[model samples]
Target: MTVPAAIQSTFDDLGTPLADVTFVVLDLETTGGSATECQITEVGAVKVRGGQQLGEFQTLVNPGEPIPAFISVLTGITNPMVATAPHIGSVMPAFLEFIGDAVLVAHNARFDITFLKVNCERLQLPWPGNVVLDTVHLARQLVTRDEAPNHKLSSLARVFSTRVTPDHRALHDAQATVDVLHGLIERVGNLGVHTLEELRSYTSRITPDQRRKRFLADSLPSAPGVYVFKDEHGEPLYIGTSIDIKRRVRNYFTASEQRTRMAEMVRLATSVTPIVCHTTLEAQVRELRLIAEHKPRYNRRSRHPERAMWLKLTAEVFPRLSIVRTVRDDGATYAGPFTSRSVAEQAVAAVHEVVPLRQCTGRLSSKGTGSACVLAEMGRCGAPCDGRQSPDDYAEIARRVARALDGDGHQVIDALGDRLRALAADQRFEDAAVVRDRMLALVRAAARAQRLTPLATSPEIIAAARTPAGGWEFTCVRYGRFAGATVCPPRSDPRGFIAALRESAEHVERPEAPVPAATHEETEKILRWMEQPGVRIVDIDGVWVCPVGGAAGAQESLDDTMTDRGDAVDFDDSTISRRRPGLRAI
Candidate 1:
C-alpha cells in the first residue's frame, strides 16, 4: 500500500540544520560539588547563532549561605561579591529570557545543568525544555586524548587555540566554551555531521567504516517496513523493522547506532532490501518471520522460535511435569514457551508445592512394586510408583494439576499462599521467599498460556484499534496467525475496510490443542495489540474468552516478580479481563 504523503513527511523529516541552529553556551560557579547541597554563586552564558554573537547573560546569586573558604578562593567570588546580588529566584527569569529556545551548550554539562535544574525546583520556577548539548561529550568524540589529555574547558581551549581563555570566573569560562563548541562543530562537519540532530547523536565510538557505509541506506523507501542488510554473497547480515525504513537504516551509519555487532555487520553489508508494509503490525510480523527464517547473525532476537522450552505433563500412568523443547498434538497438558529450563523448573516446583503429583521421573504402574522415594516419605508425593496410591486416587491429583495448568490456578495459588503464610508465621522468611518466587513464576506461565490459548484457538477474529493519527487500525486474525491488517482513514467508512480485509486475508488452518498455530512470540504480539486500551472487537466466528478462574487474577500480584529475572518470559498479563461470548466491544 502506498503511504500517505503527510505520514511520509512526518517520519522521514530530520532535525534542524546545524548552520541554522542557535546555541547558548553556559557556565556556572557553585559553592559545592553536589547539586543537592550546593548553591549557584554565579551564572554566565553566551547566545550565538551562525557564528555571530547574539547576546550574553551574567549574574551573581546570593546563596543565602556563607561561601566556603576554598570555593571563594577558587572562583574569586567571595561572600561580599554576592552579598548584595539577587537570589536565584530573581536571576533565573532574566537568564532564561536571554537563552530563549536555543540549544544549551556547556562543558561537562551534567555538572552545570544539574545545579540549574535543582535551583529551578527550589525556586518553584518552570525550566524551559531546551535541547542541551555537552561540549565535553562532543570534544571527546572529535578530539582524541592524543590531541589533548582531557576534554576539560581549559584543556580544550588550549587545543582549539580559542582567543578567550577559560578561567575560574563563570563568564570567561562560558566565553571559552562558545569558541570550543564552534571548533568541535567544524571538525565533526568533515565526517558528515552537519545537522543539530546528528550533532546531538554524535559519539566518537562510531567507526570510520560505518561512516563510509552511509550510502547503503540511500536506496531504502521512506515508509513503514522491514529492511534486510545483506552481505556480498546474498546472505542476510541483519534484519530490522521501522516506521520509516530510510531514516531507521540511515541511523546505522551514525553514532546513534551503538551496537558493536551491528557496526561490524554494516561494514560487511553489500546492499539493503526493503519490504514496505501497509501497517506497523504487518511490518513487525514480517520482520519476525524473516528473522526466524534467515537467522541473521546480527539479528539477536526472534531467530530461533524452536528453541523455546515448555513444561509438559507427561502422558503416563503417573503424570509428572517435565521440560521439553517441542509442543505436540499428543494428549497431554502443556504450560509454556518458557525462555529457559531453569524457569520451567521453577514453575514445576510451584505446582508440586501445592498438589502431590509424583515428582519421580521413573515409569509407574497401578500394580508396580518399588521403594517410595524421599518425596513420598516426606508427604510431598503420593508414592504412586510403589502402588501405595491407587490409579484413581493418583488420577485425581493429576486432574488438579491439569486444571491448574489449564487456567483454574485457584487451587494451586491458594495452596501456595497458605503454605507461604504458614512458613512466614514460623519465622522461616527465607523459605517463604523461595515459595514466593516459585508461585510467581508459576502464575506468570499459567497466566501467559491462559491469555493466549483462547485467541490462538479461535477460528476468526476481527478487531480495530485507534491509531495515534486518529485513524482506526484494523487486523484480521485467523486461528492464531495475523492474516491481514489495514488502516481506515480518519473520516472514512471502517466497514468497507473491514470487509475488504477479511476477503483478502490469508487462510490459516486450525492448529491442534497444546500447540500454538503461530510461534509464541507472534501470538504474544497479537495479544498485546488486541489488549491495548482502545481495541474493539469488530467481529468473531468463535468464542474469544479466558477462563474466569484463570491465573490472570493471581498474575497481577506476581507480575512485578518477572521484572528482575531474565529467565521467565515477561509479557503484560495485568489486563486480560474475561470477555463475554460473541459480538462485543472491548
Candidate 2:
C-alpha cells in the first residue's frame, strides 16, 4: 500500500473484482538492496487475467555496474550476460508499455518496485502510476506458517503445487508468483473476497464473536450522540461520542481496526446504549460527563479530573495567592488547573513581581508576632508581615493583583515593559530578557484566566467551529462544562437545530462550585475550539468575557521580539503559579 512517490498511483477502486482485472506479477534481480547504490540486472513479469496466462515479458539490462559475486552466483546472471543486452533506459519504456494500467503483483513488492522506481528517476522518465499489491501480505492473510512451513515463494510453490519453481532468477520467480497469486485468489474467493478492496482490507484477526456483535449496533440511532458499552453486570466498559453513533460502533467490530485492547473491550461489551444528542456540542459535553461519572475501566483521559492542580488566591482579611490541588466553594479567586505544579508556580511568581504580595508560606496577622521575610527585605513585598503596610494599603495592592488576574493586565505588563526598557538601556539585555519572560508568562496566565472565567461561570454559551470539510460543529456549554455538541452541514439552515439544542441545554445539570476540574479542562477545550480560524460565536446566554483589544496582537509583538515559538508561555524558568482571578463577593 506504500507506493513510492516516484510511482504515485491514480486512485484504484477496490470494487474492481479479481476476475475482471489484469495482474502483472513482477520480479527484479538487483546488484544490491538500495536502488540508489544498486542497479537492476534483470526484470521479468507474467501477465494474467482470470487465472489464465496472457503473456510473459523478460529482459536483461546492462546495469553499468558490476554485480555482487554472491548475487551473480545465485541468479546465474553475470555482467558478461548483460554486457551485450539493452540498457535499463531502453528496456523500461517497453516494460511500462507492456504493464499499462494493469494491477501489479510481486512478493515483497517494495523490493522489486524500488529498483524500477529509482532507475526511472535516474533516466528522468515519468514513473507509471501502477496499482500495486504485495503477495507477501496476501500470502500471510491466507497461508499460515503451519500450512506452508514458510511464506517464501519456494515454500509456497511446493504448497500450492506451482508449475514453475523459484530459482532466484527473475522470470522463474515471477512465474511462481503467478501460480501463488491464483491459489490465494481461490482461497480468498470462498470468503467472499472478490473485490480488490476486500482483498486489501480483509483480515483474519477478527473474532467470530466480534462479527456476531454487529447486531448490537444494527438498531443504534444514526444521530450524533454519546454511546456507552456496558457488560452483562451493567458496568460501563467504554464511552465515546460520535457524529454517527451507528458507524462508530460498527468500526470496533471491523478487522480494519487493529487495536488489541479495543477488540478485547468489544468482546466484553454485552450491550451498547446510545444517548441521542441534539447537537455535536451536547454529545461532546455528555461524553465528558459520562466518562467522569462512570470512570469506565477502559476509558482514559478526564477520568480523574480532580487530579488537576490550580493556583488560588485565599479569601482572607489579607489575601495572598497559593497553589491548591482543588477548586473550592469558599469565596476565592482561581487562575488555573495547570497541567503540573511546576507550571502553576511559574504563573504565581509572575504575579508577585507586579503586586508585591507576600511570598511567605503561612498566615500572619497584623497584630501577630510574624517577622518580615527576605522578599520583604528586598522590597519585593510591602512588608505586610510586620504591619509596615496597613490592611487598607495592602487591600489596594491586592486589588491591582486581582485586576491583573481578571485580565486587566495592562498595569503589570506596562510596569514590566518600563523595567525591561530600563534594563535594555543599561545594556543589560540578559536582565531585560528575564523581565520580558516574566511579562510574557503573566500575559499568558492572565489571558487564560480571563478566557476561562466566563465559561466557568456562564449559564450557557453556544458556539460554532467551521470544519475543513465544510459545515460548523456547534457546541453548547454551561458553567464551564460541555452541555452538548452538534454539526451543521454546509448551506443547511441551523435555526431549528439551534433551538432544539437550546432546549436540551436546559436539562444538563450544572455542577455546583467547587466546580469539577474537568469543567476548567472543558473550558480550555472550547476556548481552543473557538480559536480555530473561521470559527464564530453563534450565541450566548451569559457574558463570555475576553480581552477587549485581544491578547493575540500583543502576544505576537512579544513573540517577534523574543522569537519564542511556544504558543503558551513555559514559565518553568520562573516557579510562578498561574494567575488567580479576583475573589467572588465575600
Candidate 3:
C-alpha cells in the first residue's frame, strides 16, 4: 500500500521534533451522534512524548440526561452504569492537565475531537489547539491495498495479528488502535521512513494510535499491602491498597469494558509493584500514608483530607482523659482515633488490669457521691465515681495504662512473668497457677495488639497437615512436645492455613526456661486446653485424637481406662483405632 502525501507530511512533521513533542491518544464513548445533544459516557487516553509513553487516563462521566436504550445497546452504557460517575464538568480540569500540549489522536479523530471541543466551549473552557491525528485515515492508506476492502479496528487487528478479544468499547478500541499503529510504524520503517519528522507527518494524516500497553504479570501478594504502579515514564501512576493485593490488581487488568478507567490503566501500565503486609489494618495505614505523600493521579478516592481523632490520657494532677483530633506541639499523650469506638474500648480494656481506671461511659459525679460503677466492683476501676482514689494516684495509673495501650507489651510481659515466678517460688501453687494463666493471657493479648516491630525477627516456619477425620493434626519438632491441633476450615486453602499457623506461632508462649516435668494434673490441664474448640492434637505418628469422640470399643488395649497414676492406659495402634473407630491419621 502506498502512503498518502498529506498523511506522510503529518508523520514527518511529528518526527522532526522528538525533544518537544507530546501525543495524547484519545477515545470517547457517547450517547449518540450529535455532539451537542449526546453525552460523553466514558473517556480513555494515553499520553506519550518522544515515542515514550508518559501516562494513561480514563473516567466515566455522568451525562446530564438518561442514556438512550439503543445507545446503551451500542456502547453497553446503561443509565445505572454511570449513575455514580462524576459529570464531565467536574472531570474536565484533571483531564485537561493530562492532555496538556499533547497532539490528540483517535480512530475517527474528527468525530471525537470536534465533539470534545464543543463540550469544552459549552463549559467556557478553552478549546484545545494541539494538532490531531486520525488512525482511520492512516489505516486506509496503509492496509487497504493488500487486505480486505474495509479496515475496521478488528480487521486491522487480524492483519497485524494483534490479540484483541472482540469488544468495541472505548478502551478496547483504543487498545486495538494501538496495535494497528504499531503495524503501520513497522511498515513505514520498511518504506524508508526513518527520521521523527517523517514518522510524525505520516501519523498525522491517519489517526496515530497510542503505543503504550499495560503489562501486569506478577500475582499481587494476598497480604494486606500498599501497591504503586508506575507508567513507562517511571512516574507513579497510581497508589492503592488491598486486603489481597493480588486479587485487586488482577481485577483491574481483567475487568469488563464498562470499567473503562481500569481497562485504560491496564492498557497503559508498564509494571506492577507491591509491598506485602501482615494485616489489613497495616495495609490501610500504609495506603493512606503513601497516597498523602505521593499524590498519584489515579488515586482520587483516597485523597480527601480529614481530621482524625485520638483518645489522650494526660500526665497531670487530675490526668484528664479526653478525645482530641489534632496533636499539639506539646501535649499530655494520645492513643487512637482507632478507626472506631469499639477499637478504642478494646484498647482501654487491655490496659485496665494495670491501670485500674474508670471505664464507665457516664461522667463522675461532681459531688463525689454516686454508687460505684460495675467496673469499680470488678476491680477494673478505681472508684472514681465515688472519689475514693486521689487524682495523683489515678494519674500515675493512667500513665501506665497509656504505656500499655501504646503496645509496650515487653514491659507488661516482664512484669507479669516476674510476679508469676514469685508466686510459684513461694509455694503458693494455687495462686501460682492463677498468675501463670493470667500471664499467658496477657501475652496472647499483647501479641494480637502489637504490630510487628521492624527489628523483631520473622518466626521459624512450622508445618502442619489436616487429619482425614475433619481436624488438622501435627507435631512441631522444634517444640519437642505435641502441640494441640486445630481444624482447618473448609473454605481455607493451604496457604491460609500456613499463615494462620505462623500467626499462632507468634503468640505461642514457651514455658519458663528450664522446662518443668509435667505433673499428672498439669498434663490433664494441657490435654483439656487442646480439647477446647478449634484445637486439634496430633501424636508423633500423625494420629488425630479428638475429645468429642471419647475412647470406646477398643480391641487391643487390655487397660482401657485412666490409671491410678492419672495416665491413660497404654495402647498400640490397633487398640487405639478400635477404641476410636473413626480415628484417622492426618
| Best by the lDDT measure | 1
lDDT of each: 0.83, 0.75, 0.54
Could you tally the backbone clashes for each prediction?
Answer: 0, 21, 24
Q: On a 0 to 1 TM-score scale, where does candidate 2 land against the true structure?
A: 0.69
Off by over 4 Å in 3: 1-21, 49-52, 195-197, 200-586
Q: Residue 525 error for model 1, in Å?
A: 1.6
Clashes of 3: 24
What TM value does model 3 have? Answer: 0.32
The CA lDDT at 554 in model 1 is 77
Instruction: List where candidate 1 sits over 4 angstroms from the true fold.
Output: 1-130, 144-149, 166-175, 314-318, 359-387, 560-586
Candidate 2 residue lDDT tens string, 1-586: 9975784322231146778889999999888888799888889999999888999999998988888899988999988999998988899999999999898999999899888888889889988879888988888888987888878889889888999889998999999999989899888777666667556666778766776676788678777889999999999999999998987887776667798888899999999999998656567767877887899988877787666666687877678988887677777776655666666676687777666888777877866357878987788988877878888888888877776666565776677778878999999999776666667765655566666666776777777766656876777777776666667788898887678778875455555443532455566766665555555667777675566643333454665665454544445322222222322110
Residue-wise C-alpha lDDT for candidate 1, range 362-405, written one tens digit per residue: 78766858789999888988788888898888888888888888
Q: What is the lDDT of residue 549 in candidate 1?
A: 92
Q: Model 1, residue 258: what's the lDDT? A: 83
lDDT of 1 at 346: 84
TM-score: which candidate is best? 1
Q: In model 2, what lDDT does residue 250 have?
A: 71
